[model samples]
Target: MSEIAVVAISIAKPGCEEQLRVALEGIVAPSRAERGALQYDLHRDLREPRRFVFYERWESEDALAAHGQSAHIGAYRKQIADWIEHSEIRVLKKIM
Candidate 1:
């Protein structure tokens, strides 16, 4: 199966940046250790401190799907639902 990549972005609500950051950071380690995870990195926007991004690579679509269904991810979504102002996620396939 071909590898897949994902880019996820989240913008925190005003006054919730630090709390959102801590919650997001808590998922990194466990996500990286999951099955079929090729890369899982978290980044913060320099100009917009409340914006955070997750750069991820997975073995396949199934792998990425599994990741989305993970316990941590569910907990994370519930935990940050109120703190996030906006969010986006994109799945990609390399062509070159």
Candidate 2:
């Protein structure tokens, strides 16, 4: 089966870039340890300090789904909900 990919875009609340960075860093270890995870990277926009993105690759759809329910992700969601101004999470399947 083809792997699944996810791109998550987030905007931090005003003056909360550092907090967002701390929160994102906390999830890195757990995400990397997930059984189906191939890659999980976080990037901050050079042009916009408040903008952040997460690029994730998983072995399968089921694996991505499992990641959604992961305790680390759940904690991140709760922790960042109030600290974020906006968020967009996209799941993709590689075609080429």
Candidate 3:
């Protein structure tokens, strides 16, 4: 079985960094409480203030898929749609 992970990158719009941060922050607590979640962490790029990355791990690919379809994530995507310049998501597998 593969160990699943997600590396999501987001760039906030020129003046909407705070709003983007808040929206991301709002989901952490609930996401971490998810049954199949192993880890869910957020990081900001010191070199680029408007850039944020989410490092997440899950028990399996199915868990991650369920999370993508979850209500909170759906709402979050919609909420940040206008505030973000762009977003990139990569699903990964542990190699080591």
Question: Best candidate, lDDT-wise?
Answer: 1
Better of 1 and 2 by lDDT: 1
lDDT of candidate 2 over 1-96, digit per residue (tens): 779899999999999999999999899889989989999999999999999999999999888888889999999999888899999999998878
Q: Estimate each model's TM-score.
A: 0.98, 0.95, 0.96
For model 3, the local distance difference test gives 0.93
> Candidate 1 at 90: error in angstroms?
0.5
Candidate 1: where is the Cα deviation over 4 Å?
Answer: none
Residue-wise lDDT of candidate 1 within 1-96, one digit each (tens)? Answer: 999999999999999999999999999999999999999999999999999999999999999999999999999999999999999999999999
Query: What CA root-mean-square deviation does each model show from the true structure?
Result: 0.5, 0.8, 0.8
Local distance difference test scores for all models:
0.97, 0.93, 0.93
Global local distance difference test of model 2: 0.93
Per-residue accuracy of model 3 over 10-80 as CA lDDT, tens digit each: 99999999999999999998899887899999999999999999999999888888888989999999989
Assess the local accuracy of residue 83 in candidate 2 as a C-alpha lDDT between 0 and 100.
90
Q: What lDDT does candidate 3 reach at residue 9?
A: 96
Residue 43 lDDT (model 3): 96
How many Å off is the CA of 82 in candidate 1?
0.6
